[model samples]
Target: MANTSGNAYGLTALCPIINGHTNDSNPLYKAAGESHDKEVRRILQALPLNQESPFANTDNTYLARLFILNDVFFQQGNDFKRDQLKSKYLCFNSNFHGELEPYLTSLWNNNENQVREIWQHCVAFESVSNANDFVRYIKSCQLTTTLFFNGSNDQPVAEQLKALYVKQMFSEFVLTQQGKSAAELKQAFKYFLQRVQLNDVKSPSWKPGQTEVAL
Candidate 1:
């Protein structure tokens, strides 16, 4: 089984910058320096898409793992340790990469160009407005794949992806609102939860699991 616990630091660092969440004083922004484009390329290289096309075989586990990793990276403090992060990534690869290979090979065998556009969008997601936009994109891709491939198993897959997205978004939102008083933060978080619940009502598939979003 693939280990889905590892975080995607590359996306976490890049997305906030792209969405204007980070500033010059931020360590992540400083790390990118003047060559932000180069840094993006380097990060993409570090976390490449599956060897095969993303649209063909239809296993979203790898994609989900990427989002999970990105969330972890986003939540890291200014005192982030490169050595520790590297060790975690190594463990993630060892545990999950092998398991994901067979599915990727099947996807590649089925179509070389399938889902290429979505893959490009994912890698070049800096233009995305925020975490919500990013999550919606993933949900859309999962839904599109389901419709195109006529797969019944993908609904749950898409839900899982949305759940992860929400979890990360909430975490990031809370981080940004650090100035809020405890009561204010709590109220804001409750309101956010209500919004998420309403969204889920509109589209049940987007509903996260009970424990997915914590206070």
Candidate 2:
């Protein structure tokens, strides 16, 4: 942490960089700051956030990497893959998209657009600075990940499977928009299905009575 800043002013030395409330020490902030300088900013840019904190810590970069990994991983599996021409990433990118839609909508509806924009600017994660491009990244993914679970009459599994088809279409749309032919979509489908088969392999198969049965 900042080369210990000498024996007398140890922690007091780092007040200019990190929030003293969180770090509270010289060696901690120093070491963290050095690591952050190298990794966090670049990863945040790759995640393509609006702005990167010059002094973000290792924790922030680690999380950004996880997001990128999840993006690629999701593109690989079958059932695990998203359904739609778009994905969870895109739809969620919408300024106000989320599970708490009703509440957000209630606010959005009753308020004037000007007031709504102000509130959005002042409150909520989406409203705040596009920290690390968080909202855009999520919206890009969400365009396709909707469950669309009918919840009407079919069993849960049926509805869930219904979503897979949509996710497949989503991949195709992405592939197409990027200039891949329709045939390439078929290829990606095959690639992901193979991954799904591999994931299936991780679980033991069923036996008449000696197996873990799911309901």
Candidate 3:
């Protein structure tokens, strides 16, 4: 795979072709740790090409973050640290235990497609001008809602849901009270907390915050 050098972006200009072998006694392919790391790095670097930017493409960013998190999880020698990292990063079975290049490529492509779907279905995302707005848009979108509930529990959908809620709250404070000081922001947050009740439905009960806050 490393026979050809990568471009300036650390991505290969041409994907290497692996010929199928008909031999029954051929040894199974095993990826070296170093090779896996290199492939992960390459994929992360190329992720931006799949979209305008990481911030504009949450699904792609999500996949890139997963690769980084999984890499960190693998590098730790301590068992306890590894376990902790695993709990946080390795939520879903991505079927990444096989070949390195193909698996990483598949992940990047799949995320790219998912981001496209999100953009197509979620019109609110187009009007997002800031991080907070982006979060609110994602929270209000049905695509994210479906993914949050029907999607795999092992995935980072739960983390995404939490992030959306937090961003939505922060954005609400900023949008409604434009000239508020830090003290005012804090007070608003406290007031919001007192009035907001997280019921069994997990939905917040404010004007705009009353959207479906799923996990």
lDDT of each: 0.38, 0.29, 0.35
- Which model is ahead, 2 or 3, in terms of lDDT? 3
Model 3 score (lDDT): 0.35
**Which one is best on TM-score?**
1
**Best-fitting candidate, scored by lDDT:** 1
Stretches of model 3 off by over 4 angstroms after superposition: 1-155, 193-215
Model 3, 59-118: lDDT tens per residue?
312322323333243454655444332211211112112233443344335444543322
Worst 10 residues of 3 by lDDT: 7-16
Cα displacement (angstroms), candidate 2, residue 64, comes to 21
Candidate scoring better on lDDT of 1 and 3: 1
Residue 163 displacement in candidate 1 (angstroms):
3.1
* Model 2, span 1-215: residue lDDT tens: 22111111111000011112222256765666543222322333444232232111111111112211112233666557454422111111111112322322333333334222222211122432333333332333332322222212322222333344435545564665576678986797686565444334222222211222231
TM-score of 1: 0.25
Model 3 root mean square deviation, Cα atoms: 19.2
Cα displacement (angstroms), candidate 3, residue 190, comes to 1.8
